[model samples]
Target chain A: MNSTSAPEPAQPTERIPAAERREQILAAASRVFGERGYSGATTDQVARVAGISQPYVVRMFGTKENLFLEVLARALDRLVTSFRQIIQEPREAGPAATELLASRLGAAYVDLIEDRGILLSLMQAFISGHNPVIGAKARAGFLEIYRMLRDEAGFPPDTIREFLADGMLFNTLLAIRLPDIFHEDPAAAELMRCTFRGKLDVVLDATAAESTDADAAPAPPAAGHVDAAKDDK
Target chain B: MNSTSAPEPAQPTERIPAAERREQILAAASRVFGERGYSGATTDQVARVAGISQPYVVRMFGTKENLFLEVLARALDRLVTSFRQIIQEPREAGPAATELLASRLGAAYVDLIEDRGILLSLMQAFISGHNPVIGAKARAGFLEIYRMLRDEAGFPPDTIREFLADGMLFNTLLAIRLPDIFHEDPAAAELMRCTFRGKLDVVLDATAAESTDADAAPAPPAAGHVDAAKDDK
Candidate 1:
């Protein structure tokens, strides 16, 4: 089953236009993988979707695995770009950093779930190990976002950080897939947002309170050692 | 593709005991469906796993579709029984209702994820539309759980009740699947628990606040003739 030979480089007569063909192939690969999953899908199906021959597809992508990995990578890039764009959008310019971050992140989540439900499907497919080659990359993309939100998003650092990470990702899935599950009952989404905001507020308030308490208490030289141990060991 | 029906359930064979045969068949069915998913899995494979003839498999379960539904339903019933047992467990004699609910729910969740990882695969198989026969039942089962939690969990009637419902279901899925993504990190599971608790606290607090607000507000008079305007047309 392994066809290991690398196809010869395209000559002038056989050369396809770069940008359009690449996008077309990627779109075909994405839809096919999304429908049939990686293991069940075939190159012929992808080629049929792209309106190209299987040989041409192999020439461009080398193997089905390579093509799937590229599609997953592109999906991740799309998520990162969408997130960054949402974050940079103007939200209550004068609010404190944490509140501003929360509102912005929440709004971004709503937009992504509502508009790009397919991305969530794609992410689920990748993470569920339906396709081994893309699964690793998809997981890396997820962990990358989790880390960025934990380290970069201006939330008060505490136990709540992990909670926010998991809850955010989890609720996003529900919001995208089962919109009807919440549609007939608007309270469903509202309750989720309220809980999310309220818990975040608690963490923020408590962290701020602790900061003042730290100022009043004598600085212990051993506190830094404990934190370093927590990080390192 | 339909095979001729076996002769009205052949008289019990003495080679195997009745209950043991049933257990062996069910266990094999689970493994077959779990591996190939509902649509792709075949009766022959199930028969192979059960170490019985294909005709015996058919006689035992009627059809492949019927067999798939049986396995799915059996899994769900087992899950319900497990959860009910946890909820009924004695909890320190007199813990607060809300805290007791949380601890029991959390323990059930941990047990569900750890002891039943195949459930995640089963859920994904159905949700991803890889198995339409099982998918319909799975979706129905989930919707039923959502209703029970939202309506019967004893939260006072309010918008936050819906939020609690959504979050509770969402947290359960994360508890099962997030560990797979963060497999090497010991903190992943702990983080999931903290996040669930914080969010649950938000729902509880919000419900309490809403009840207080309702108590302070004057009752609105019943609208006896609101239909008068529509009747005029």
Candidate 2:
């Protein structure tokens, strides 16, 4: 429903390929949508962030809603692929078998701070009601993640529900930028200490690095990548 | 910073009291912020929903951000007051003592569908990170809820974490309006049936009733109430 035919041309030094341009836009969309939110973000901002023309963004994705759908799909793909890879990996068997798997999955989710948008963008999607196409796609993808945990991960429904809930909680901490303030607020510190534990330093460091880079430039998008490193549980 | 002096005046036939009028705006803000989110809502829209003049809205709550802070405080107040009341209520304890408390708390949360905005508005607050005044206030309130469960309810850290996570998940389901679609999607239905357990029909009915009323009129603002029914765990 973007009726903006007015053009704001991409001031690219040279012509970028359409496919590459689309990837750039998606990457930019993730950050913009994640930071600003789906309802709040506009293609013009995404285009500006991507260093592309506004019309070009509309041409490729058609609408902000559609672009957010792609970001959601991408985030879900990252979760599926990452979890599958973790499942396939060799692990030491222990008395607490599921705990090991859960820890790895938890670490993978924390590691997603490398691409913070994956978590935050999904936050935007979760709150969008189910009647809309985004709502349907998001809930279905969320369930797909749920089913993966249930069927493949061999976790019970309650366990899977807890895992998903924990993931959403972690997502909340990040979205609220709690990592930045854990040192300041005692309650936040206690919670972060408990939530992150050993990874607290790592998350803090990742957030620091990301913020520093964000101040200087937009995050290098996870364009055209399907690696475990991009896995945002 | 809403600087729009171009006023769209309220059409109230008679004068409404200042205290009552303030409550009306807060109630309207809850739904508006819950639905549109903090970043997405404007004072103009909040004023419209509250049936007050835009300039009057600006006069009462200096900015949209300030208005949201009040809404967040109100939601947290409702949570605290409700939970305290539940704790005070006499219970028929048996072999499963805490389960009774937990169930009562869960029912209280479900009962919050009466003012769905409290849950959804808090959802908006939870995901807001810790630097902005909103982020700081929201997280602190959230942790207050956490500590209450730990000290008063006497649940362990992991259990508390799980409880908060589950609450967040429930908020996600509501935010995405998953209850509305449970009948249509099998995965959704299975999850709803499991999550809602004995309260599925109640949640579904409440949602249906809320949606119908929402279509017909704004669900009544929970202005200055501290009843057990408002306890959104």
DockQ for every model comes to 0.07, 0.41
DockQ of 1: 0.07
Best by DockQ: 2
User: Clashes in model 1: which pairs?
Assistant: A191-B163
- Please, what are the lDDT tens digits per residue for candidate 2 over residues B55-120? 888799888788889999999998888888997788776777776777778788777767757888
iRMS of each prediction in angstroms? Answer: 6.2, 2.3
What lDDT does candidate 1 reach at residue B180? 50
For candidate 1, write residues A1-233 as lDDT tens digits: 12222222232223459677887778767655654555556676666556555677778888877887787777667666776776666666554766667656655554443322235435444334423445456555655655556655644434235334444444432422333333454544444344444443333232233211111212222234554566433
Docking class of 2: acceptable
Residue-wise C-alpha lDDT for candidate 1, range B57-130, written one tens digit per residue: 88888887787777767666666676566656665545377556654654554354333223433454444343
Candidate 1 Cα errors over 4 Å, as ranges: A1-18, A40-59, A88-100, A113-118, A130-132, A156-233, B1-15, B18-67, B86-96, B114-118, B129-132, B156-233
RMSD of each: 22.6, 8.1
Q: Which pairs clash (backbone N, Cα, C closer than 3 Å) in model 2?
A: A176-B128, A176-B129, A176-B130, A177-B129
For residue B205, model 2's alpha carbon misses the true position, in angstroms, by 2.0
* Reference-based lDDT, residue A107, model 2: 90
TM-score of 1: 0.58
